[model samples]
Structure formats: C-alpha cells, structure tokens
Target: MSKLVGSLQGYIWRGYLMAGKNTNKLLSGQATISSKSYAYSAKEIYYSTLPYAATYHKSAVTGYDPTKTKPETSYGAISRSVISNYQPSMTKAQIQTVIAFEQAKKSVPDFRIVDVPYQASDGTEMVPVVQVFSAPYRDLDDYDHDGKWTTEATVRNVLLAQENGSGKIFESNPEAQQVELVGPQYAFPDDDAAMLSSNYYGIDNTTRIIKRVGQFVMLSSRLKSGIFYAKASDLITLNTNKPTVIDGIPYVTSMPLAPASPNHYVDTASGKALKAAGYTKVRTLFDDSMNEYRLKNGVWTDSLFASFETKIFSPDFDYRHVYFNVSDTDEGKIKSNKVITLNEGNNDFKKLLMAPTETLLGK
Candidate 1:
C-alpha cells in the first residue's frame, strides 16, 4: 500500500499518516472528544506554518540530484491526516462549522482557515487549510538568487484579500493547508546548529550564535523592580556567553526580555531541561499577551497561553515574566482563546488563500 501524505508543521510524513492509529503515543497529553456543537478532539499535533512555497525542489539546498529524488506530486496539497485530527469523525456539517469558526477567529495571528477539500481512507469528507504565508527566509540573495527560487517561493507575511484588499492576492492557490512541514529543522535535533538556520526566524535579522554547552545563559524579563537575572546551564547553547547576577539571581544581562523569538528563549535542549524540572509549559508574558511553548519529542512547540486585556504584572518584577512554574489549574484570571463558534462563511476568505504571493515577494 502506498503511504499517505500528512502535514506536520508543513512537511509530509510518510507511513505515519493514519489519524487515529496510536494517536495516544503521538500526543503528549491524552485525547478527549469535545461536547460542543462544533465538537472536535482535544488531541494536539505539533505544527508550524508551512516553511516553503507550494512547489520548490526539495534537493535544491541539499545539493542532491533531482533525478534521484522521487518527486512528491502532493507536495503542497493539504492532506487528510491533518483534517482528521481536527475532527476524526467530523460530519460534513461539522467540518463546515469548523471552517466557519476558524474564519471568524482569523484575527488571531496564527489562526488559519482550512479551505481545501480532502477525503479519509473510510471515504469521509474533509476540508483543508491554506497557509497564510510561506516560511521566513534569510536573505534575498540566498533565497532568490543563489537558490534560483522566486521571492513568492521564500518570503512570508503575504497579504490576503480578507486581511488586506482584493488588489493583493495570489492567483494560483497552492492547494495546501496550515500545518507544520517537518524538514531540515529536525535534521540536527540535538544541537544549536538547527538554531543557526534562517528558516527558524520569521523575520530577517543577523543570527547571533553561541558555541559549547557551558555558554548557555538564562535571562529574566525586566521586572517592576527594574532588575533582571541570568542563570547558566549546560543543557542548552545560548547566543551569549555573558552572565550577570543581581540579588543572588544570575541573568543573561540587565535588559528587558521580550518573547518575540524562541532562539532568544530556548531550543529543544533547554526544552528538555524545562520538562525534567517538572515544568508543564513555559509562558512568556509580553505586555498584554502571553504565549505558551511546549517541548514534545524534544521539539519546541508554539501555543498561545493567553491574551490579557490589561497588562500582566508578575506580582513582583522577578523571574515570573519568563520562567513559569505552575499547574494547569492555576490559570488565575487569564482567559482561554480556544473556544470556537460557528459563523456565516466569508467568500473573501477563499480569495485570501493565495492572492498575495507577488505582493509579498515585491513582484
């Protein structure tokens, strides 16, 4: 039997395509069925924004001969494996409801609408998601010139008709969905070398680097007390070698830490340290918003912890801004954004799928 294509992040998975087969093993937490009208499973799959355009030769950067690599015809199409997890037993009405819910909540930065069509092995219908933009690239020279790739094939943050206007939309839709595409990012799973790649950062910037395990340092976000501390660990490699201590607490520097970049945070190495230390998740509180990241199978995952209507204060200007140690039941006053409700469909959403490639690429 031929293997089915499943989107994890945005990369295709081969044999591990079945949605329910050993699902318990794949998820860090137990799976449960929701009782809402738009009922869905609580099973979480580690996903990232599709890191590349719909059709780029996989062998381009690896220097592999194209002739030797069997081309993937379904390279950019959203696969059934992803939609099934959203609602393994979803009826057509339920599927449509899910789509409506996503479209209504599109204001969330990472929220995307699954607009393509799919079918299950059992002949069930499934809807697909369109990725808002391709993965972030390093430079125009490397992504466009040296690689012989178009800006449409590399750049991110494409404008959509729904978000922008009809004047900015890509004509030929990639026929794909929003899920993590597992690729080179997982190759060097055990080292900071993976962090060196520009594909990791969503924006173009000089990638600061550090070497050796001892160079790792942890910094706290600036607190109300105007103090920040750093701690060193061999479990991960940080971009800085400098560690400063204030009030018996070591910090990366006397600076305010923002949770914009995970590299400035920690990689899988540090993720393991966090897990082993009995921390369920790391919450990065920035101004009015808080985001949660988890390490499953030694890979860091992106998840929103909360969106505070008012600024979040850590009670004291201390480590609470960055490193969080708490149980799931201690959510205090933070509101959960996972609730989904059905709404009328938006036709502009379909145009938003692939209408901004040229605009984003500056064509």
Candidate 2:
C-alpha cells in the first residue's frame, strides 16, 4: 500500500523500485494466466466475464496431476499453482521504460540524494517501522522469515520513504536517530486461501479478537464466541456519556472488494454494467467503508454483495455460508457490507486480514 519515492537515492530507492516492479510483474502474470486458462472453453471464457464466475466454471477448467494418487483438482487450485510458479518476464515496453529510468538514475548526483523524514499523525517523528532481525541480501547470513530477502535497513528505509499511516515530512530538517523496531509478521497462505475460497471443507482456520484495555494489550476478556480486530489507539477513549461504557465493534465490516486470488479474473461484463449504471468497481480495499446495494426489479438488492462468498463449488454450496453484505447503493457500502464477521466459526473472516500469498508482502 506504500508508494515508492522514485527521486530518492541509496538502498531504499532500489528496494522500492524492485518491489514495485515485482508487484507489477505479479499482477500482469496473474492477468495473463487468468486470460489464457479461462480460454479452455467457450463456456468458461463467457463465464469468466460473469460475476463470481470462479464458482461457475471452476470444474470445467480444472485439470489433474496424474502422478498423484488423489489428484487434487480444481481450477482455483491448479491456476493459482501455475501463477505462483511464474517468473518475472518484462515486456519490451517495460524493459525500455526500465532502461530509461536506470539511465536517469545514473545522471543524478550523489549530493542531490533525497531523504524524506516520516512523521506520525500527531506531527511526531517517533514512528515505528517493522524490521525483522536480518542482514542485507548480499550478506546472506540472515533472511527475513517473511521471505522478502530485504535487510532490516532496507525495510526501515523503504517504509520511512513511503507515506503510509502518517505522511512523510518534506519541508523541514529532522535529526536521524534509531527507532525501536518490531519483530516479523508471519504469513499464513493456506489460511488466506481458505478464507478467500469460502469453501473450507477440509481446512481449519480461526481468527483472534485483539483488544487493548488500558495499559494491557490482550484478547478480549468477555467475547468468547466472536473475533474482533482493533488498534490500541482507537480504543483509548471510551465515551462514558453513551448508555454503555463500551461499544461493540460490528460483527461484519466491508471494504472495497480487492480480489486477492491469483485465479481471480476480471468480470468485465459486470464491471461494464456497473460503470454504465454510474457505479465503478474499485480495486483498493477499505476505500469505501459502507455497504453497496443494487436496484433490481424495483427493489433494492444485496445479491451481488452476497454472491462473493455464497457462490462456491458443489458439496459446500449448500452449507458454505459466510456473513455477507446486502446493500443497494455505493453510499457507505464498506460500512454497511459486513461480509467479514467476528465469529470464530466463520473461517472466511481471514480473507480480509490476510494478504495475497504470491507477492513480496505476503511472502
């Protein structure tokens, strides 16, 4: 979610650029694979353009590994495996652009290297960047458990240059000092995929309710049956003026749909229809915090929203139900659509919390 500052020099510049390039390659590869694989049949190609088409044409496009005794086969499984195995291969245009950029980089003087300072929302420089204990890639003595072969300095420098959380400072000069860094953030790919698939037939995954009560940060004490995620800062002030001393977090919350699956293909038909109807499908998650709704047959419907989690493969089709958002408009759709619920029984809740597995962040 962080933007690369292209004008900066040193390791941060290279890391950001490489990370951006890798991300671009991964996305392009996913699109290409999805396009080619879905062309297996006319029906599949047509269905790929439909809303939640993954559910409709998964079986037809699926192939098996004959060598395996059980041959676990599903279009989602096979296509995702293929996508994960792809290597970065830049197009001619991309190569040309990279060449031009590298040429430009060589022209910049060492003295002109830019170092933007990061600051918190309260205009404080005491910001924390997650940096695992690892040495540089060249050293090879240490490795990031997250699988992003970046060093601690590379992670810190790149994160600081980006304008995430709080914005970066541009005008004034600030003193450079060491800040306490946190440990690594683990990746749970199977959990992520299971949640997104919403068809956890043989998989077991759970969500934890994290809360901060005063100075102690711990799991919620009373909510035994549900899960919730909240930042400590957000829970600092309790409005006592309200009838209740504590307010409950929503069981389900919605974000702008960001398809994390490598097998997730663009539903151009649905996208075009929505655009013609004055609605645009957004790629950024959490941009809209309200539930979205559509008007159908003179009635407001949430069928489209529910379709994301409801329409899956057979067998689980009847019982595989996750909390879904039902809305009729884009207004506050993220807030209204609560597909990701707090119940531990709902494994699909992990879909919102985990990142896609193929990328650097996920690794």
Candidate 3:
C-alpha cells in the first residue's frame, strides 16, 4: 500500500488516503477507523484553514404585525474580505539563521533562552541545552546588499539608491527581528493542545507530529500552539537529536489520552494524564466556551453532546472560579471545560461516549 495524501494537511499517510483524516481527527478526535498498516507522521505539525465564505444574515423584525404579514428575512452573499491572519511557518533556512543568532545570544539584548534535548548513542538522553535569540535585524544604511536576510539583502540597494551618499539608519536587525519569537519546546504530550486540535480552533486533530516512514520530515502543525513546521535542513541539529512523533501520522491518538490513575494528573505527562484513574472514557471541558471532547486509545474524540454538571468551590481551598463538573450520573452533562468531578452512579458520567449509544455500530 502507498501513502495517501492528506487533503486537509497535504501530507501523505500510509493508510487510506483520507482527505479529512486529520481534520476529522481534529473535528472529532481519533481516526474514524484503526489502521494496521504503516502511517506517516511529521516533524512540523500543520493546520489547514479553508476559508468558509458563505451567506450571512442581517437581522430584521421577526414579530408578526397585525396590519401586515411578517416580512421574510433577507439573505445575501458575504463579500470576500482579506483575512490577514496568514503567518506562514518559518522556513528551514530562516530557522537555522535564527538558531544560529541565538546560539550567540550575548550580542542580543533582552532575549529569551530556550532549552531543548539531545540523545546519546547509548539511548541515554542528554541534558536539555539552552540557546538565546533575538529578532532578525536589518541595516537600512545599505538597503540592497542582496543577502538572504531581507533587511540585509537590500542594504546595498538602499545605499546605491541614495544620493550624496545619504543613508538614514545604521542598523536594521534590531527593528527587523524585534518581533517576539518563542523557542521550540521539548515535544511532550499536551492535553490542552489536543483539545484545540479539533474544530473551533479547527487546528485539526492532525496537529501532533508523526513522521512519515523513513523521511527526514516529521509531521507537525502550525495550529498546535507555538509550534510550526520547518524542513529538517532548517532545524538546528544536535548529536542524537531529531524531532519525534507518535505514529506514522501525527493524529489525535498520539496526544496521550489513555488509562489513567486517580488524581494522577501527577507525574503523568500530558494526554496520558486523565482525571479519573484507569478510566477508558471521561468528560473534559474545553476553554471558557463549554466545548467538550472525548478520549480513548490515546486519541481524542469530538463528542459535542455531553452531560452538564453543577460545581461549587473547593471546601478546603480559596476557590474563585465556578466549576461545572460531571455528576456520578452519566445521563446529566456530557461535556465541560475541565474535569469537574465524576460520579459512578447509574449515570456513570465516565462511560459517556460522544456518539449516541444507538449511533455506535458495535458496542
């Protein structure tokens, strides 16, 4: 079998060439079905946003008037407008350049240093290393230098274009690269990120990174919060250091939702940490907005219909925010923004599945 090109994310997967696999995973949580064959994952996780341009409405009177019949609501096509939200991922060359600059951080002021890990030949892990970096710099003094850096590239041009050898700025790097840049974090399982992978954020569940079979590339997503894809050549290399992914495909299952121990949000890493210990299913709250999702076999699922729970402040702690929790009864609330509480009563909130009981094919 050959890798199927992902329609949404554009990467090729080993299993079915499903178009919405990643999106479905993002929209729901987990692949629609399991695969026994090899699946390709990625180093740079990507989230695709297809602009949804549809007809919108302008609200008008809805009540019926005694003198005249109620007027029908008018609908019109939404005018296409420029959505400036496009921040393309950094290129490998750009990543390398930035890493190189950060490698020599003393030159830059007020820079944030990031820590990353490298592995040893003996399968032992090397202590995480730190690198400090600042934003890109440009020198307007020579606007057209034709260098890789846009600011540097045009330095000479600016000088040539000037008359009487007049130039305004001495250095541009301080301004060009002044933008806040976050160094890459150690790729660890994250639950909040997993929830964001699906709709709304619509980062798509294909957010996690899984490398395709035998490629320098590791699948990842820009939607996965502060993480974006760059070619392997662009990534900084350390001895025994390369990006890692869960399966061949960086789908939702890779997020670490699994059998958990009670209150062991303890040392348990993200995704792997579940509220109810050893639970196969549990209700999870998402964001301030009441979005709910499910988890199973390490994969997150979109089960919008969830039981609502009522919560009160912790008796022992200085509680401020109100918490909505799942009752011991499963029939109540199916979704929440956080793990409020669980009850094992006839409602067994833990067993709630996003898919309706009858909607599920085989128990």
Candidate 4:
C-alpha cells in the first residue's frame, strides 16, 4: 500500500511539470501569432493608403519650387480681376458725395495744404497740394547735404532747378534724371495706446509729396494724370479743393502715399542707429554669456561688447547710394553694394519691390 501511494505521488509530480511546460509553449506560440498578425495589418494599411498620402507628404518632405511646377490659376488673380471689373450702380455724383463725407469726417484742424506745381504735357502748369499735418520741430543744420531739413520751399526750389537744366541729370538715362523723396518724413508716436485713440491718431497724419530734386515741384506721369515721376516729360497739375477739369484735362489728387519708415528709432545706449545698422546673417558666440567678449583675430577678447563690426560707405551724396562691408572671424571680408539702374529695359527694381509681397502671399 505504501509503495503504491509513493508511485502515485511521483506520477502526479511528473504530470504537474509537463502541464507547466505545455502552458508556457501555448502562451509563446499565441504571442508570436499575435505579433505576426499586427505586423501584417500595419504593412497592409501603409501600402493601401500610400497612394492617397503621397500627394501631401511628398511635397512637404521635398521642398517645392513654384517655377518648376505647372502654372495654375491663383486666388489672388481671380480676386483682383473680380474687384477691378465689379462696379456699383451708384451715380458719379453720389459716389463723389460719399467720398466728400468720408473726407469731412477725417478733417484735421492742425493740417494745412501746400500746393506743389508740375508742368503738364501741353506746357500747362499743374499744382497738386498736399496736406501737411506735421513737421520736424528741431531744425536740421545740414541734412542730406542740401544745407537743411527738407521743407516745402526747399523741395520746390530743387524741382525748379531740375526743370531749368538743359541736359539730363543722369547721364545714362533721361527718365532717371529726377530724384524724388519717396518716404514718410514725420515721426509718429510709437505708443500703441496713443495710436488707438482717434484724437491723437489723426494728429500725426501727414502726406508724402514726390518733388523732383533741384526742381522742387510735384511730378506726374506723362501718359497719366497721377503723380508719378517716371520720365522728364511727365506733367504737373494744380491742387484743387476737389478733382477739377481745367481746359480739357481732368486733374485729380491721385498719388500713392508712402508708409512710415520701419527704422524710425535710434538706439542711443549702444550709440548705434537701429535701422542704419548692418544685418548679420550668422551668430558667432556659442552662448549668450559670451556677448561681453569680442572676437578679435579668431580669439575672444573681453574689451568690446560685439563679436563683429560692420561699415557702410556712401560713395556719392545719394542716400540710396550705399555699400556695406562686415568684418568677422568666420567671414574675413564681405561686401554688398551692387547697383541696379532702373532703365527702360531693366525690371530689377520692380522685381525687388514685388519679391517681399510675393513671398508673404505664397506663405
């Protein structure tokens, strides 16, 4: 009886070990099967959706060039055409009345009008008066080498001189003879709170007048009635309270106003003019704490605050005529001063102006 009991116990122990091994093998096989199934499903889904996802993902991974792609109808072109062609059924007098009402609402008390003269195509004199709302309080001793800050009288004198000249001012081109100031002069309040207020907002409002240098008079396009100094033969018109028809030509106050200069502030602490400072493409310092040390001859020194230096050279008295050079350890000497003359066949100026707008619109 004792032997039979021991044998039964031995058989039970062996059965327990075999069951444990079989259970582990079943679990391992199930795990392997589950992993294979998951991988197969994942591959199938990826392959199936590859055709659909390729349209969006491919362009993102590889940079897209618009010039290389086929031309497509753009929304800007469509919208511009629609806006230009669409006209309200309102009468001309009604439209003028509405415009007058808007102008009356924006009438500034401190603003005064100054008439600028321009010669018309038919040898007739035209005057386009601009509303001067603000002028520099501090007198400029010798700004622009013209002996003083630009004023209405000074601008007029410059234009008169240009008109009296027998030969063109620019030797290479006749159209480039006239040099007009094409930017906002007034220094508006930088405070955002003051800008939001209606009273202070219109107080700093000023107009941009394109007066030819040495012939200081308003300029107009030769083919059109607008204020555009494209050629020497461009006409000048008289300023009126409203668009007035003198003789046979209709004279209207239609000139593009220049926006305020972005580089309006000067950093007095650093003795650097914010807008006048040269642009740096790369940073030299490895850390922000190294700003106190300056890079000299490829070695860092604690004497200066900057790691690099920039120099701007203006060859002629022309403000636009400028050449810039930067000195750095990484780049020994870099110069950037390529002149692009705006002649009859050259569209470089137009391309430069449009490039920024196009990049913004594309994004």
Using lDDT as the measure, the top candidate is 1
Residues 260-322 of candidate 2 have per-residue lDDT tens digits of 355332333443444455443222112111223333443233322322343455564422234
C-alpha lDDT values of all predictions: 0.25, 0.24, 0.24, 0.21
lDDT of 1 by residue, 1-363 (tens): 111223322222322222433332332222231211111122111221222222334433321121222222111122234323333232333333433443455362322222222222223233333223222345756754223211111001111112222221111222321111111121111221111111211101111122222333211111110111111221112122232222232222112222346344334444455555555445332222234444444545553333211012434321101121121221122322232111211111112111222321224
Please list the residue runs of candidate 2 whose C-alpha ends up more than 4 Å from where it truly belongs after superposition. 1-118, 122-130, 133-207, 210-288, 298-363
After superposition, the stretches of candidate 1 with alpha carbons farther than 4 Å from their true spots are 1-94, 105-127, 131-250, 254-363
Q: For model 1, give the 10-residue run with minimal summed lDDT.
A: 150-159
Score candidate 4 by lDDT. Answer: 0.21
What are the per-residue Cα lDDT tens digits for candidate 3 across 39-75? 1123111111111112112212221111122211110
- Model 3: lDDT of residue 42: 31
Choose the strongest candidate by TM-score.
3
Candidate 4: tens digits of C-alpha lDDT, residues 91-185: 22322232233235465222211122222212222121212223223347643221111112222222332344323322222222212221111
User: How does residue 132 of candidate 4 score in lDDT?
Assistant: 22
Model 4: runs farther than 4 Å from truth?
1-103, 110-114, 118-125, 130-332, 335-345, 350-363
Superposition TM-score, candidate 1 onto the true structure = 0.17
Q: Clash totals for all models, in order?
A: 25, 18, 64, 19
Per-residue error (Å), model 4, residue 101 = 4.5
